[model samples]
Target: MGNITETKVYMLDTNVFRYKSNPRAHKSYKKATKRFWRNVLQEFRNGESVLYIPKEVIRELEVQSYTLSEKENQRIAQLLELIEETVPDLATPEIEHQIRKITAYVRSEYKSDINAARDMEYGSVSDARILLAAWQYDCIFVTANIKDFMLYPLLFPQNESRLFDLLSENYVIIDPTVYENIHRDPVFAGMLQDLHNMLER
Candidate 1:
């Protein structure tokens, strides 16, 4: 609470990963997230914190990472494989159950004896699933999905979205705006270069 440094776990999303490849998204936020990522590596080097990727997040980002850089593409592949070995899959029964339970609860909370949700307005099931992962991991859902995640709540009056605050408290979900805080540290400098050099060999 007082010190931001207390946040030890980070659950990233595809949108956050895509920022490295998509300059347009980075430009919108003034390239803050890009810089933060470099910083994240630096912190990781410095042992500031631990980075844990939900299996699904890794799968989701791989498709995009390949388009960005030969190194990034390859790196994503390696990460995914490692994650597969560890968690093996993203959509497990527990995750699905969590998604379903959250959906049902949210639906009930949104229940009005007035009207039903329109197909277009209700959005997709994927939204709930992503939210579920963030909740379950007790980590932030780091995403650049401004239009969908951030702005959508404004459209609904009783929309009940502590989505950002809720996650920030439990999970520290950094948007492009907050990434610099996540990554900037005295820690990540030569560690990554050493890793790169080792990998090259």
Candidate 2:
């Protein structure tokens, strides 16, 4: 009812998968993960939706192996099996330029110093890559931490107009707690109905 929603083509963030794999992480996130499988993946496997896991997200997950239990590792492995791995075309000048700007933007926002030594070490570059992958594939970028990605456009309104458009038209940022009751909540219920109609078409 708010806007025409895209039911297919989703690009997932690392945290979305992490919450599912790690049992002790957070109850709400785990519930969101379960609901995502029930609500989204069912349609995805049925050929109604396309799902992508960026290579950068995969790398992030791999690095998290040190803290994960064997069961968590197994869950992550199985989860990866269900997604289509996407390698963002980093060769594009636009993408490279955006990544740099996005990294700097994140540095300023999180570290309060754009030239902080953290640089690529703080996970900004990888986040940029994942977002660009969504843009490249026209996939709805899915994440529980929406603010992390939304900060880019807020800093560079003119240069990131396309991203603004993408955010408005395709971004599917969901709060974990809200997502757990998606069908019961009015706002999310409307979104779900919109997606259902789109998929049926």
Candidate 3:
């Protein structure tokens, strides 16, 4: 057999885990969702890729878990255990500085979109912190909340320009929907294949 290939590192968002915990919630695309997660977990199991979850994302999941039904809470507990075994949690003192920088940038650039008085609220900083963690680790930031993250590249044009210059690079953001459609659509498969190929290099 040929040598085993190294794959990209994926820094997962909270929504990705939420969907993994309850793929049936997306009944219309249940099969596709299941296949997507199966492929992702297989990559991890095969040692092709490393998975990371920011500490902030874990905190969010823990908070959300408390509101779930007993069965769901048990399910989440098991999932968290699996994640603890398979994925490394990203945490550092410098993360706070990055979060502050991101918050300042967002507040300044999107001032009209946010309530200035409430800009410093707790919930407002989580996403920024997540993105900063992904950026810091140079991982592929995977999420279901695409629109929210799409703003990052636009907000920081210099980074976008740098990313374009690097033919095979990291810090790209992707949506799990790409995986959800992989079996039914050639386009989705092609997109994932391309990412896989790039990461392997």
Give residue 61's error in model 3 in angstroms.
Answer: 1.2
Error of 2 at 138 (Å): 0.4
Best-to-worst lDDT order: 2, 3, 1
Go through the candidates in order and give each one's C-alpha lDDT: 0.42, 0.57, 0.52
Q: Report the lDDT tens digits of candidate 2 across residue range 1-201.
A: 765555577787887778777879777667767777676778876777767877888888889987889899898888888786566544344444455554444444444332233222223556657766676566656776654465333222222232212212333223333224332545434543443343344
TM-score of each: 0.47, 0.60, 0.55
TM-score of 1: 0.47
For model 2, the stretches where C-alpha displacement exceeds 4 angstroms are: 1-7, 89-123, 151-201
Q: Which number leads on lDDT?
A: 2
RMSD of each: 15.8, 13.3, 13.2
Pairs of residues at least 3 apart in sequence or in different chains that clash in candidate 2: none
Give a tens-digit lDDT track for model 1, residues 24-141.
Answer: 5536443656555666667766666455555566556655554576766664554344221222243444444434443343334332311233211222345545544454454434
